[model samples]
Target: MRFARTRRDPVEVNLTPLIDVVFLLLIFFMVSTTFETRQALELELPETTSGAAAEVSPVTLVVTAAGVYRLGERELTPAELASALAAEAEQAREHGLVVEADGRASHADVVRVLDQAGLQGIERVRIATTESRTGETISPQAETP
Candidate 1:
C-alpha cells in the first residue's frame, strides 16, 4: 500500500489594493497643500482699516525701507526711476500706477514717485496697503501732503 502526495499552489500577495490606497493618499496631499511664493524683499506693509481692491496696473514700483527703488525686479536710482516711470507711463497710462512701499519707507520716497507720475501725465495712482487683521479691506490711498 503506497500513499500519493498532493501538490499545493504557492501563496501570493495581491498588491493592487495597496497600490490604489497609496495613490489615493498621494492625490489627497497634493490637493490639500498650498504653495506661496515670497518676494526677495522682506517688506512690512502698512495696515489699513478701510481699503478697496485696486484694479490691475501695468506698472508697479516698489520702495524699500532703505529708500531703495525697484521697478519690477531691477533696482534703480531716483533719476533712473523717473525715466523708467516715463517709459512705463507711455504704455500704462490707462492702467495707471501701483506703488508698494515698505511700512518703514520714508514718506518723501513715496511722494517723489507720485510727483514723477504726475509729471509723466499719469493721473491714476494707487498705494498698496495690507488689510488690518480685524478687517478684510485692501485700500490704497495717498496721504495728504
Candidate 2:
C-alpha cells in the first residue's frame, strides 16, 4: 500500500491593520498635545506711544482718581509708598519705577508720587496709559512720570 503526500501552503501574517492603528494613534497624540505659551504672571499692562518695552520688573505704583495708592495689591499711604520705592531702588537701581494714574486722578497727586520717587533716587520713571479703541495711546498729557 502507498500513501499520498498532501500539498503544504505557506503561512502569512497581515500587518496592514496594525500599521494603520499605530498611525492613527500617532496622529491623535500629535493633535491632542497642548503647548503652553505664557509662563509668567498675568498683568493688565498699560500701553504707551513712545515707550519701548520694559526689560526689567520695575516697582509699580497704581494711583486712582480718589488719590488712593497701591503697591502690588495692598494699599499704601504716601509715606509707605516713598519708603517702598526707596527700598526697591536700593535693591536694584537698574529696575526703575512705573506709575499708573487714572485719567481722573489729580495732577497734584501724580506730582507728589513723582517727587517721592525722585527722593528715592529713582531716575527712570514711566507713566502707564491704556490704548484707545483706535489702537493708539490715549495720550496722557505728560509723556513721562
Candidate 3:
C-alpha cells in the first residue's frame, strides 16, 4: 500500500469581510463629510434693458399688476402713500422708502410713488429690483443690503 500526501489550498478572498469594510467606509464618509449650502438673494427679478438699475432691495413699496400700490400689505394710492410715509416719518427719525413695481405695472406709477415718498421727508429712496442680493442700483439713492 502507497501513502499519498494531500495538499490544502487557502481561500485568498473573504466576501463578508470585504462587505463589512465597504459599509464601514460608507459610514465614515457619511459622518465625516460636511455639507455647505449656498444661499441665493431674495426676490425673483424681471428682465430689463438697463441692467444697471436692476440691483437693489430695500423697504419695498410694491405696485401690483392691477396698479395697487402697497407698502408691504397696506395698499395706498399716491396721495395716501404720501400720508402714510408722512405718518411714518413723524413717528421715526429717518425715513427710507423703496418702490417695487411689477414688470407689467406702469412706469408712471413707480415714479409717482417715488415722488410722493420723497415729499414725505424720506431722504433715502430706492427702486426695488431683483438684480443682486447686496443691492447695487444706480438712482443716487443708497441701496440697502
Candidate 4:
C-alpha cells in the first residue's frame, strides 16, 4: 500500500486577530477622545477662590481712576485705543474684550474706551471688577438699557 505524504502546515503569523484588536483600539479612542472646550490663554491667570472667571479672552484695556487707558502696559488715546484694539485684535483668536476700569474710575471713562473698542468692530466688551476684600476678579454685568 502506498501512503500519500502528509502536507506540512505553512508557518505564518495570523494577522487577522491583531488587525481586529488594532481596529477596536482605534474605535475606542475615537469614541472616548475628549474635545477641547475652552480657548482662552492659560496665562498666569489671575485667580481667586470665590470670585467668578472670564469665559473668554479679549484685549484687556485697563483704565485707572486717573483716566489712564492701557492695554497690557502701554497707554493709548481714544482714537489710538481704537486702532490699538484693532491691531491687537489681529493677534487675538477671539474678538471679545474687557474695559478693566477701576471702581473709582468714572463710568463715562469706561464708556468712552468701550466705544473706542467697539469702533474697531469689537462688540463683546465687558467690565472687570474685583471683590472689595478678596481682591478676586469678578465678571462685571452689563447695564440694563
Say which candidate scores most in TM-score. 1
Worst ten-residue run, lDDT, model 3? 136-145
What is the lDDT for 101 in model 1? Answer: 84
Off by over 4 Å in 3: 1-58, 90-95, 131-145
Candidate 1 residue-wise lDDT at 85 = 86
lDDT (CA) per prediction? 0.76, 0.69, 0.62, 0.69
Taking the tens digit of each residue's C-alpha lDDT, what string does model 2 give over 13-104? 89999999999999999999997775432334455466444443446788999898987788977667777666677643476667779889
Q: Write the per-residue lDDT of candidate 3 for residues 39-144, one digit (tens) a residue.
A: 5324333444565653333456788877778876688876687776666664322535666677689877866776666466555555554545666444423332
RMSD of each: 15.4, 15.5, 16.3, 14.0
TM-scores, each model vs. reference: 0.57, 0.53, 0.45, 0.55
The number of clashing residue pairs in each candidate reads: 1, 0, 0, 0
Candidate 1 structure lDDT? 0.76
The model with the greater lDDT, 1 or 3, is 1
Question: Judged by lDDT relative to the true structure, which candidate is superior, 3 or 4?
Answer: 4
1 or 3, which is superior by TM-score?
1
So what's the TM-score on candidate 4? 0.55
Better model by lDDT: candidate 1 vs candidate 4:
1
